[model samples]
Target: MIAPPSPVPDSKISLWTPFTFSLFRAIWIASLVSNIGTWMQNVAGVWLVTILTTSTLLVALMQTATSLPSFLLSVPAGALADLTDRRRMLLFTQGFMACMATLLGTLTLMGNISALGVLSFTFLLGMGAALNGPVWQTITPELIPRPVLPFALTLNGVSINVARAVGPAIGGVIISYFSPGYVFLLNGVSFLGTWIVIYSWKRKVAVSSVPAENFIGALRAGVRYVQYSPAIYAILIRAFSFSFGASAMWALLSIVVARRLQLDSSAYGVMLSWLGAGAVSGAFTTGIINRRFTVNQRVLIAIVIFTGTNLSLAFFPAAYWLYPVMFLSGMAWLMIMTSFNTTVQLNLPKWVQARVLSIYMLVFQGGMALGSVTWGTLADHFSLWIALVAAAVWLLLSAFLAIPFPISPAENLNLTPAEHWPEPTVQGDIDPDDGPVVVMVEYMVKVADIPAFRQAVDQLVRLRLRDGALRAGVFTDVTNPSRITEFFYVATWGEHQRQHHRFTKEDLAIETRVIHFHTGSVPPRVTHYIAFPKAPNVDIAPPFENMEGQS
Candidate 1:
């Protein structure tokens, strides 16, 4: 046996490529102006409500109005991104937002603004945000290649944190010297710069042609894809849980510092800056700390660290300690979020990358919306510290609870197939007589177990085929040296149902070799079918055996 020397990787193949940096710069600049405006509006709006209304409910409700759109609109928006040109769609949304911002600025400047007007505008902004949020995430993969995709996403977080730090600080001063009305005006103007830059890009993003009429059908496909993929589902769950549990501070942080810590609004802004600073640092550190970790591993670690660090803030006693706590919280959160972004971009096929990412944005942001309302209510009733503490606990609890769904490789059911596995009939619009139904399910398996698991998983696939069940099954994306996703290809409703209903000693035998070598990973969430158009008509009955009834 000959021992082979390890080959050295090319240094020129560095993660920070020119294209990524350019796109990053453009997006960063755009986000910078927009984010500052966003933060300014956020701070001023919440403060205005707290000052004018005695009820904390009103203050919390104001926060609710801002983020609720994400919950309602993220997934559908993602499907739209897939169906249409994401860049053009973003332009429209940005215009909507700019108009809304300008309107609010005009009314505020004229001294004609009422609380109801503010609330109404808040909903309008939410509407724009909901439309924008999902598509925004999907755009990243189109901007960068696969290897440097992580770096690009990390760069994004770094940029956002920079804005988070600076925006509030500047907004505080502006609001102090001028008025919250001016923040709206500044934000409105900022949109034009981004719009111009995007419009001016020499090369336009090119994607496959999608028909205008297939909008509803495309949406159903994306949703069906999500439902069938356990890895994707787990990713969404991890994201949603992480966002829902950890977002408590987003709403209450200002109130906590201003009311509880007895700090001025400027000081509160400074503290937020510190948090953003931590987040930026965290993003940079991930590039170094994460040597060869898979995206899922990094995501899991980030969530744990972010949740843990934020919890520390709740227990800290001194006001001076607040800075350190907020900073660490930001840092850890940056790691988790950047990891999540990179994972989604890397795993999804270019064809539907934006669409899946958009769904991700919806679930997570919607979680944020609910978290704001829930934590805000809790903070109003209980002590701010108690609310923060509870949020941390929920975050911690969620990590463990969410681990079982095959989000990462560390959990049980660690097995990966050599090829894409077949799933049941998932695509609703397509009939059984059409083509095969495809569903990708990610799983983690030990490196040693992969060979045996391949056979084991194959047996499972063949069982469905013999029963006249699964049409096709293959491995799609392997998470690392250890984990892989088995994409199932089953055709029709009968085969789909049959695969789930019957498993005997014969079916169990193949798993033995697979399990012997297996460490463990999460089991794939079986999906019936993913919606893709093929069978347009259903009236012509083949009088095929009732596979559905028998299965």
Candidate 2:
């Protein structure tokens, strides 16, 4: 017999706990090398655009090209990740990006690269990243236990920032001595490590009785989940708002270094490194931040720091002062991003994990894409300072949004699948496609408890709608004043079955509370009905017309 799993550790767990898992450690190291190469390419690509054109719009367009695919494709990609074998999907995307990076390098070396060509290649790479993102995010749970997931995400941030700290600086040195072609080539080669790691791993496949969801249906389910989840949508709003305002620095940093500070590409790389270094520092402190403050408070602090960084770029524009400010900016980015990521991850169950994450990717990247163009246009028409100042002001205003959409912590939630719903009894082998399925639960509530019952059932209504109910309602019997019934409709027999798997301990608790108000002699009665079948060749007579007492 298999040994029982170890008990989960406490809240004060070390930040490095995830590294104890060898698979996680191996994957993390491989991903680090790949991320470094990607960062190097990012530095080279952005600087190359500056060399090709003086137009601020063209330069900012580079950032847009990188973000736009994710904005457009993340939802579909999420659905695909959930529906397909994620390991294979990740392998394909990594290989695709490696080839694209190689081709870009070759083109640059041939002296045939243009502004549009660079942007086009960047867009292709962005598509690969877009496809890779959701699968990559969802894989952490497989690598380590849930208790360590938050820190694992923090460590993921560390990998990116450590690469950020090291990559741009190294890319700068390479560019100073050689051509960007070499940097691109190195990036192409870097994917080998991660590609090999993923290929070597043996992934466990889960066996389930429920059939896999179709693409369109999976997409709809994900969208529906987000529609009713207030905590999640609040996180999305904050993510979009933060990225929208703060993207100015990323979109225009090259121009700021070249035009305002009169610094070389090497200095530009150094500035980015400082930002990365600060982020690396911040990653270690996230555990402390989590212990010390709420998610909303952490995000608020990050916004304040980021606003300061933008204001410094707008007003100071001095190299001496900016080194530290950029460092602070990195820390701010790490704090807020990890907080959003961790909260979202903790709140999701295994089934919908990738799909919802893809939605998060859509909002986060969508915000950056739109914001880049907005800030770039402002810079092109007016001045860089005006753009920076405007962005800083907007970021400051984003802090107030927290008041209305405060983040709810996921620490207390029990997201493990409840699987408590009993199998619905049926007379025949019901086709999964048969629908629409109607579910009714009869409850006996006395007049004295109707108000309390209604209030509790109201919460139940949201729970039903959130987990796949197409429509739901509460009704009272006209002849029997004390008899009340709650009804809901699912789109298909299969969907109703899937909904059985969607409930968590938290959801069951809400439902249990609603059930507590029932005054019936027996437990609430549940009944299921399917839509009447139509026979094309035969005429059907109504059963009620043949009743014995019928007139």
Candidate 3:
């Protein structure tokens, strides 16, 4: 069994402890500034669309344009993050967004901007954000020690919410007193801080014996890993459900303030600020909540609270009531999102973290994009109240999903690399890009242990596939009733080598269980075979004699 991580001193485990690390602190501060600018830009963009068009669909479409890129590009971006230099990728994406924001601000100031123009720029900015997200997340582990990683994640959330709390009110004030163009321009300038911080970071490059996978290979491997991981799938499902329902308020808040509450831009900003305030409160308290509740319980409570808030927002017309309701909504938002993110992180090994996270990002954003349009169309056709009520109903139903797909904490799982697999014995030189490689592991099992052995090997098949096996199965010897051979295929010798690196301590435990069932005198005997084309007349021969080994 894998041992638990060493205990962090209680004094260093508090909410603010992540700031003790210099790099994390620097990056956090810079990111906070950038996130504030982003929130400001969001406020300006949404408000601008509302002003330029009377169509609720068009206004909602603004959110769709921004979120759609995350759905389309997150997986590829995640693959890139895993396969390339993450810091440099972040710098490029940030710079690209800054340019997009600047161009948007310029056009708006020059009186050359239209609804379509705003959406085009918003889409471009979204693309940059999508590309930057996985890289940014992957870098966090490099910045802070494991003892404080959870706190660092929470701190990241807090920074965003803190920006949300401040940016909207400030953006609203600027829009009211000066112009929306100024808010956009400020956002454009804000990216410079993040760029500088990323550039200044002297990040250490990881040295690996094997080269990184090609883009397509990385993408496929990531997908395969997630497919076999039930924990990740559950998290994705919950995230999508929550995001779909929660998107209503986010996508239509400006319109809701304008049409339902009869409020000005400044008032709308205050509403958003209150929501952010609730989020901040939730972030600060998450550590305590996590200690008290299970993952499933936390998610359930958050959903119920958020649903109530949505229903209240739908029925209550008073402006003052929105403040308390939105505050509650913010709290629920934090609880749900933080739980989902932490659960996913805990379950994943470093090898596939970014790729799986990208999938999570895709589902979350895709749900929001689709939900925005649905709610907007409902609002346009019927009323805002009906739209919100419908969304609230859906959220209420989503709470039941947790029953079948319960969220489990990953503390018990040993995800650290085991590095226990012995290197394959090779008799001759083999190209790294050689043809498909087949491996056979022979086990001598008594008749009484065959059923148990089969079950154990079945589990091994999944692990093998998750770690890059192309195909896997078990076979019985025709002449020897007690001989069982477990076999698997990999596209290349290089992939089989990579699989050795992917094995975790938990996987090692499983391997131990399988080995106990083997009744062989020594251990399971392993053999490797590489396929080659048949010559015109000559028979291809096996490379080595006694081609047997052990793992």
Candidate 4:
């Protein structure tokens, strides 16, 4: 008799969910109003500072104040967010920000505000934003299911770019027509609308965690987690590059439009609008990624698309072509940012979710902050187009850096490339009898050694768990697979111990199987990770079952 077909995995991630749409709409509204104020404040603030101090250093310092909180305290706040009620935390932050904005407006109306006063209020706003940033991210998955989590994340990006494009024009108009203080009042009032919506809502999941008692200990823990992780580290570096290389353009874009393109304010506004349209288009386009390519391929594609866009911006002939070029660049930005964010959500565990996000913010937007200042300085000396060209060259260089490390995308037991696999995913402080942490590492391994390596890997797993600190195992490939494709896998340890830790030499024997097994005539290419899903089901694998109480 013919055998029945094996069960196929369920794979339908909704692109259009009510929860997703509501969250997107709410955030877009919030951003549109507040960002308009923010942009107006940014433009007016810088110009105000320039008029007051007549010093670029003073203006630079003012801009830096806006981003300082993210650099200084996102980690601790992230740990705090993971420990407390995220929504409640956000409520407090939002309310505080409104008060700060109101005060700034009040001072401006009284004509009593100074550079120092501006700095104080801006720093307060940054503090609230640091708290809001982590919550904004980690809270989303709780609202929408995992399947649509990516869609929601992409939508989140769409809202930000829309704000980036539109907020400035409105800000400029309001500031020019009335005074800048009116813009601040608009932001203060806008918070009430968001607050009402949040209060009326009911959540489907509890998006809170027990606070880590040792605050510094928790901070160190977050750092060490990425330090030991290859895939996580690689992604972090990619974010850093994007921030440093590509993001500098934002600072110079206004200058380019004003001087290089010799465009008037209205023309600049039109050009900016094209960016939002491009980003929205790119956001929707990524839904097909699951159907067409692996995560690595999408990453590579994002890099190429962004790099090409930047190159076009660097070489555009006339001011007329600027709109079309900026539009495509916006699209490219969405593709890169969304794909990277999805990778973060796909690869992390709930326990460390906020911490990873904190790091992502530190690297990505932090890099932008760094780039902005750098570009501003560059523009004072060089022309804006020269600055844009310099930034474009750096963008191309960063993408090329990623080409060497291509993490394979086969979700299985052994995900790392053969030689460079880190063993913590298999045997570490984490409890294995409980389950595996699915880490994604990108490295290189050889093609010819597939057969013998598979045999050795099978041998390692069959061996009983080692009694020492390292307890390791490996699963062989179901298919021989591509010659040099990136691999993804699930690695299990019974528990992740947070207290004091120790390891013995006995842990090394079986743990080294994947590295040593590739004995072919040539070396193999590979990359791997030990991933921790945001919400892990302990029952799916009995190993994770016993781990519930250990940590």
TM-scores for candidates 1 onward, in order: 0.69, 0.89, 0.88, 0.68
lDDT of 4 by residue, 381-420 (tens): 9766566667777766776666665543323222211222
What's the CA error at residue 270 for candidate 4, in Å? Answer: 3.2
Give each model's whole-structure lDDT: 0.65, 0.88, 0.84, 0.62
Model 3 Cα lDDT, one tens digit per residue, 1-551 = 21223446755487787777767788899999999999899989999988987888889788788877887899999999888888789889999999999889988988899988888899999999999988888777667656566677888888889987888778888999987888888998989888998898876776877646889999999999988777788888988998999898887888878887788987887888788888888877877887889989988888788778767767777879889888888888877777787778778888788998898878887888789889999999998889989998999999999888887788567888898878877766776677598899999999999999888989998999889998999999999979999999998878888888899998998888889988878989998888765112337766565555623
Please give the range of 10 consecutive residues that has the lowest summed lDDT in model 1: 410-419
- If ranked by TM-score, best first, what sequence of candidates would result? 2, 3, 1, 4
Candidate 3 vs. true structure, TM-score: 0.88
Best model per TM-score: 2
TM-score-wise, the better of 1 and 2 is: 2
For model 1 the TM-score comes to 0.69
Q: Quote the lDDT for 227 in model 3.
A: 80
Mark the 10 consecutive residues where model 3 has the least summed lDDT: 1-10
Number of colliding residue pairs in each model? 31, 0, 0, 46
Backbone clash pairs in model 4 (N, Cα, C under 3 Å; residues 3+ apart or in different chains), count: 46
Per-residue accuracy of model 2 over 426-508 as CA lDDT, tens digit each? 76667888789899999988889899889999888887888899999899999986899999999888999998888888898
What's the lDDT of the predicted structure labeled candidate 4?
Answer: 0.62
Best by lDDT: 2
